[model samples]
Target: MTRFYWRKYRSLGVVTTLAILYLIVRAKNYEHKAFVFLANVHPSEPWEFVADFSNMKYLNPTIIDFNLLDESGDYVHWKYSLEYSEKLSHWPHSYNTAVAHFNIKASPKKDSYFIHSTHKTCLLFGLYCLNSVSEFKFSHGNSSKGASCEEHIQYQCPTVLSSFCRREVVYQRKAIMNNLFKKFDGRKF
Candidate 1:
C-alpha cells in the first residue's frame, strides 16, 4: 500500500509542476493603437527631431537619461531611463524608475520619413516583460509648411496588467502629440 500511495503522490506532484511552468511560459498578445495628427511644420523638421536621440528629453519629461549604444547605416540602438508613478485603487502612489532599450530603423523618402522602433523592458523583478513597437510616418500635409504625422504603437504585457499598460500608452501618446504641436505650431493642442 505504501508503494501505491507514493506513486500516486509523485504523479500529482509532476502534474502540478507542469501546470505552474505552463503559466509562467505562456505567450501574451499585443494591443495596438494608432494616432494621427497635423503639425504646422515641414515634414523634415519633425522627422529630424524624432530621429535624433538627444532630443527625446525635450519631448518626454519623464525620461531622465538617454544614451546611444550603437549606430549602423540606418539603424540605431539606444537606451533611456524614465521615472513614473502609479496609484492603485486604495493604495498610496508608488514611484519607480525603469530603463528601456530601443532599436530604431529610419527611412527617408522623397517627401516623407518613416521610422520603426522596437522597445524592450522587464518589470517586477523580471517576472513581467514588456515589449512594444512604434511606427512613425511623417509626410507633407495639405499646407506648404504643414506636416501630417501618424504614430502606431503595439505593446505586449501580461494580461493582469494589460489595462494599466493600455492607459499609460494612450496617455503618453497624447501627451507627446500635445508637446509636438506646441513645439511646432506654437499653440496648445
Candidate 2:
C-alpha cells in the first residue's frame, strides 16, 4: 500500500510540473497588432520626426526621460525612463518607474521609409519582463493629399498581465499618433 501511494504521488507531481511548464510557454508567446493612419503632411516629414531619437519624449508623454546611448550608420541605441501607476483590487496603489532599452534601424525605400525597433524592459530583477518589436512604414497617402503610416507591433509578457500590457500599448500608440498630428497641424514641427 505504501508503494502504491508513492507511485500515485509521483504521477501527480509530474502532471503538476507539466501544467506549470505549459502555462509558462503559453504566456511567453508574442501578440501582434497592426494599424494605419493618414496625416496631412509629406511622408518625409513624418519620417524625419520619427527618425530623430530626441523627439521621443515629445511624442510619448509617459517617457519621462530619454537618452541616446550610441548611433552608428542607420542604427541607433537609446534608453528611456517610463513612469506609470497601477491600482489593483485589495492592494495599495503603486507608482513605478521602468527603464527600457531600444535598438532602432531606419531603412529608406524608393517611396517609403521603414523604422524597425526592438524594445526590452524587465522588472523585479527579470522576474517580470516585456519585449516588443515595432515596425513603422511611412509613405504617401492613397489620395495623394498627404502621408500615410502603417505600424505593426508585437509584444510578449506574462499571461496574468497580458491584457493590461496590450491595452497600454494600444493607448500609447494612439496617443503618439495624435500628438504627431497635433504637432504638424499646429505648425510646430
For all candidates in order, the CA lDDT equals: 0.60, 0.60
lDDT tens readout by residue for model 2, 70-145: 4555333323333332222222243223443433334444466667776665555445656677787777746465
Lowest-sum lDDT 10-residue window in model 2:
83-92
Residue 24 CA error for candidate 1 (Å)? Answer: 7.5
Q: What is the overall TM-score of model 2 with all chains considered together?
A: 0.67
Report the lDDT tens digits of candidate 1 across residue range 136-165. Answer: 777765555577777888777666556666
Tell me the spans in candidate 2 whose CA falls farther than 4 Å from its real position: 1-26, 32-39, 74-110, 186-189
- CA RMSD of all predictions: 5.1, 5.6
Q: List the residue pairs that clash in candidate 2.
A: none
Off by over 4 Å in 1: 1-27, 34-36, 74-109, 141-145, 186-189
